[model samples]
Target: MVQADACDGDADRMTIREAIREGLREEMQRDEYVMLYGQDERDGESFEVTAGLHDEFGDRRVRNTPISEAAQVGAAVGAAATGLRPVVELSFSDFIGVCFDQIMNQVGKTRYMFGGESEVPLVLRATEGGTLGAAAQHSGTVHTLVSHLPGIKVVAPATPAASKGLIKESVRSDDPVMFFENKAIYGERGEVRTGDRTVPLGEASVERAGDDVTVVATQRLFGEAMAVADDLAGTAELEVIDPRSLYPLDAETILDSVAKTGRLVVADESPMSYGFHAEVMARVIEDGFFSLDAPPQRVGVADTPVPFAPDLEAEVLPSAPDVERAVHRVL
Candidate 1:
């Protein structure tokens, strides 16, 4: 029996928490096979993203597992292969290391190794990024490394609206998807279209338009890029694009934007060394190097562990000014 009601089919503003709750609730109601579990998912999740889901779906559907990352992933994979859709939350992206074996060898390569006999239609949601005083061990934007793995789709949504839509789509997809929620902007509010809303994976959304420089950002930095571009409106026309899905990258959109703009800048929260910004920079170089007027620029976190102090953390992480500087460099 369906416990939680579906979306009301009306557009309304909501926090990221409310939006994600609606998405998980809607998906659970739409498919009886869909189940959600994590550390504290049943008793108001640590981040409160899945708050109250247990009450609506009951204990059998919303479970809280032991703090065993490998066990959680292995169980989710087994359940998915047996005709069940399980959404597992790893709490934080940094904890991905605990289940790397399962994710890399078992879940990631199951379908290919089995000759397409089984599908791991599991959605793993994890809180990502620093800036909340969550120091080194607790914070990470690990999508850069995770995206390198085959058979796993990486998704990072910018706003509440995109969060609701993309998460709903991720739950319904027939492949394993790693969904990262930026922990810093969880309380930010936005308009979310109700009733079966979805933003397809691998599509890039141009947040702002310009003719001189293109700024492509991921995760929470996507909005920061938009704001920085707005600040530079009078000086230079800046176009901001959010490539929501990192793995099946929207290369065409970014390439076209670079072609028209003649310059590119990537702003990401990850470190500069082999980071998410490096991935975007490499893409532009490989496909549209000839279109560039100046050297491509990247704004990313410093190569160091995130500090607990706010001031020290600010020094390492990329900010609006850093993005502005990078944009100026390519211009």
Candidate 2:
């Protein structure tokens, strides 16, 4: 679902990792107050997503932090409150629980509690979702958890272009943003707009246009839905929508699509019960109830932990076939 002409002639083909690094570099150059710090960030660690960043920005702006989630996030909150824009990398979204108190209480409530006098312009970056066989502990899509909190903005970019634009937008925002990068799509290549182009935080991307059904997906599932739409092309026209920003979700685009197709299939990697799919389904039913031609279907992981075993994990995780079936059910 990578856009062929994302920025017209002002675009380049880059992996999601490179696009993110480029975005970070641009932001750092654009604003002197913007800084990035986290575990092994100076060395770029295993993924090397921030490999050249430390070399360019040096130790002051890209220093490594101790292995403490609470401290990393708490420090980010403090840094943001004092006028610096800090982007803290948490390594894995699964480890967010260790610092949930800091995120839920401090990062989420500082502005409101201070009567809008204080601004925590922080960005919490983490790699999330499965498909690498990293097992349950390292591969959980927990954006839904952060989205439940009141003040934080949740973003899950599906393509390299989005990865670049959303990161820049998240860094510049005057509010705390939880930016979740799907671990599986870092190497995926796409055309990324150059210059100061930034995708707004609350807008959705219509990856594919169709007439029969609308498939709303997030993160990795967005690509999966696109593939299904391609395979089922001509047989069933499927409209694919990627809700790039999960919170401040572009529900209007989704409602409009549902109104056109009269069918919905929300596909996400999170658990099904009380998860993102449920939230989207609830919104559709609440606001676009009469537009439904059939009961909306949700495709997601089973109500359980992501299994360590490859086979069990495959069984629990929703796949392209699951999305296709859901689309067919509504059709």
Residues 211-327, model 2: lDDT tens digits = 999999888888899999999998999989988999999899999999999999999999898899999999999999999999999999887888888988889888899999998
Runs in model 1 deviating more than 4 A are 1-10
lDDT of 1: 0.86
Candidate 2 residues lying further than 4 Å off, grouped into runs, are 1-7
* Best candidate (score: lDDT): 2
Full-model lDDT for every candidate: 0.86, 0.91
Best by TM-score: 2
